[model samples]
Target: MTTKLPTLPSLQIPFNQPFATGKEFDYIRQAISNGHLSGNGAFTKKCQAWLEAEIGCHKALITHSCTAALEMAALLADIQPGDEIIMPSYTFVSTANAFVLRGGIPVFVDIRPDTFNLDESQIEAAITPKTKAIVPVHYAGVGCEMERIMEIAENYNLFVIEDAAQGVMSTYNSRPLGSIGHLGAVSFHETKNVISGEGGALLINQPDLMERAEIIWEKGTNRSQFFRGQIDKYTWVDVGSSYLPSEINAAFLWAQLEAAETITRKRLALWKQYHQGLIELEKQGKIRCPIIPQHCHHNAHMYYIILPDLESRTTLIKKLKTNNINSVFHYVPLHSSPAGQKYGRVSGNLTVTDDLSSRLLRLPMYPSLMSEQIELIMNTISQFLSSQ
Candidate 1:
């Protein structure tokens, strides 16, 4: 599905605008001419092959959305009714819901105060007899401490599934974000750095799981192998769902992938502009800019500022809206939500998660965003802080 363009004055400065490469429409029209609008078509194969080459994964399967990819990961991980999945509470609901759908209990953990990522130090203590996997979400395209997280998972013989919905073209320790884990999920939703309106990919690193991953992606059928002449017929062979996206979505995404490097470069330039503009406010202790670790490289998926308190954040958002600038807050602590209380349990004190989530406010971030708009945003923030 395509995103609707801005209509109102306030929408002119929207929180997000779906980007497009010059070839998107051309490729989509080609997909129509190819006479195959179903999943796993030529366009879909090109997109998957691009992901495998770019991310350096053993296999890549395109799915309907990131949530679907995570669900497929859960199925491949063999999550049981009482298995426990450890993850940070400061994440999208799909991270937990994927496992929960398999009857796995989510073990909610706190995040690091700096990167807002799952703290590796806290992970070891959270392991138990039922612990099945460690799911580390790369918040804001910044890599988590994957080296340590991988060490912990290896020692415990547990699976590592990366929830890298915001981490395409981002790396940790010179390795791609999603490719570091046993199985990884990436989003191509409208809000992410690379978008297909509604699409995602499951990246397989373990050779053992590569074949099964394709089966799950094809609704538990061996259709992929059958087409390759590895088998004569295909039929349902496992517990899975229809996770693959349409050929149209894959066509649009292929255009984006061809220009992924250019897109990331533009985004990084915009991120630097935001960082430079907010330096004075940050130095004055009025706000906190996002922190990127020296060992990691991010795709500049988003840019946000942390206020001193929730009240300050609310006030700033209101002020921005008054000036036709749209600002928004991020996730609520999952442990505090009703669904979380019913289906998950806390691993430890979530002091950092609660504190950071409340004060964080996301600013306008998109490739097409103008420098003048950023200047106005920074000036408005400085003026508001000064008046206080």
Candidate 2:
């Protein structure tokens, strides 16, 4: 009798996986067949309408990327040199970079360990006369303390720009995440639940800001009105950049948006599976998992686990690689990063951020992550820890 070998599992599991429903092909076909490849085309309008209707945002302008959308927000806020914008340090660099580009000072704040979001309690102490805005990033698709943050903003007479990059369709107390702030930015990068290669949207919540927001998005030109026939000819009106995404990208995103509910449902199911499957290990002190706050209805954008320490985390990652499971980690605190050191000013010691970065690991998550695969992943992690 010949001895049998165990089946090989793929070593590298991608951190984020996008799902393409059937509607993507249909929209791509329609977009190509229609021959309008410019920005602000029919599909763009459709996408805008769908988002406006679904997200409850006053208006949603598709942009080239989340970074662009953030830039637009800073511009709309009239962020001048030395204007301080407060945000948590544990976030994508773009959260601070946007404000930095507009000559705004970024005040890096520490995050609450449990939620991995800006510590609302720590915010009031950081405000000074130069503080112009408060950027509350919705980390890992989890909601921040929006109501509390807003109250502080109102009291301090500050602008609130929500970085909803990972929180699309995720809500807080039945209200959408982006709409709660004056302006918000969302991402549709390939790593997101819905993708259009590289794309984003700027959410305009204040009706008064709509006209200016549109202008800034069109590179400070009145091109949007020109396309809408409200103006005979578009001209350079203000300072801006090419923030609009192409029609093809909009069309591709439209496909995903059309099937948004379905995609969300599938991903949520997988998220729960991982949560339940890994509960035992977490309870046994092997690792820790995410905990959704009371008000948040998260989109399951990522599923991360915190190991005992850096050495154990490294050991587990290596074991997973040996098993061909491509798990990963992300975002060292920006305040400590080289670029952040040059521009933004750090506030306090980032103890929580430093601790979390060393222990956290993002597991493979996608709409197609089947139940059996989740079991395999959980078992492999468990086996690796037990072996130690």
Candidate 3:
């Protein structure tokens, strides 16, 4: 008898779901018909105002991408050649890339095993005479130890740049992630909770820094004032780049912001479901779910499972693929990556990062993911673990 194996299922579960189209089109069209399709138009202003009011940001500048927003942060902070920035190794390449682009040394530090964020305890030890800023990335939408990090930054007179790209609406001690530092950056890439296709925002927390923030957002020009009629004409005041995103993208994001509470409730429910459902597997020493701290509320951005080792994690991913599930690993420690080697310094061992990256696998988690899909994914994992 000939037996046939089933084909691997297309992730039908994409890494992210872009915005809902109908409302988005209406909003975008409203911006266009209102006679402005350029940057900082009506839609852009609405988005910015909402972010400032709701997200606890003093002001927000919608940009082309989070990467651009981060780069602007580096520039505004005056990150110069030979300056060092402290950040966790278990982060998106952009976190380090932004600083490095401004000729800043990326001082890599290990992450907490549980939170997968920068180990605040290790940050002070990594600081040097030239250390300029400390960038704390709130990994997986869980807030980092901001209090301790801020204390350290204050003591050393180092600037704090919160990479709150995933921490939108997620808070630390009741204060929003982006609003906690001197400056912060948020992402609206298709992969993030919010959507503008390819967009982001820079959040200025320091009241004194808002003017410079706006100037840099307008490509180092005083155009923001000109647009406000505060000036008759605008010209380059200092070095800057084109960071503002078009009104269309900002309109799309406005829809998401309006539905933020709804979307967050659903995602948080799904996150709890995953936790409760996977707890059995965790107890069996098969997988580990996220460790949510008492003081924090997470945004359900990423749901990861840490297998016992590299081999088990790889095997699980392969098994999930065969069963029509798409699971992926993240961030091989940057220090070991080719680019990290070229520009950064790895002070101590990244044993935790090395271990976790190999062992961690992110599952299908989104508002659209069905209950049936969840059960099927878990059943497949159970079957695979039983076999092992």
How close is every model to the real structure, measured as TM-score?
0.98, 0.95, 0.96
Residue 218 miss distance in model 2 (angstroms): 0.9
**RMSD values, in order shown:** 1.8, 4.6, 4.9
Candidate 2's TM-score reads: 0.95
What residue pairs are clashing in model 1? Answer: none
Better structure of 2 and 3 per lDDT: 2
Model 1 / residue 140 / CA error / Å? 0.3
- Model 1 Cα shift for residue 149 (angstroms): 0.5
Model 2 clashing residue pairs (backbone):
10-324, 11-324, 11-325, 12-326, 13-326
Worst 10 residues of 2 by lDDT: 1-10
What ranking of all candidate models by TM-score puts the best one first?
Answer: 1, 3, 2
Q: In candidate 2, how many Å is residue 350 off?
A: 1.7
lDDT score for candidate 1 against the true structure: 0.93
lDDT of 1 by residue, 281-368 (tens): 8999999999999998999999999999999999999999888889999999899999999999999799999999999999999888
User: Over the stretch 127-215, how does candidate 3's per-residue lDDT look in tens digits?
Assistant: 99999999999998899999999999999999999999998779888888898989999998877877788999999998888999899
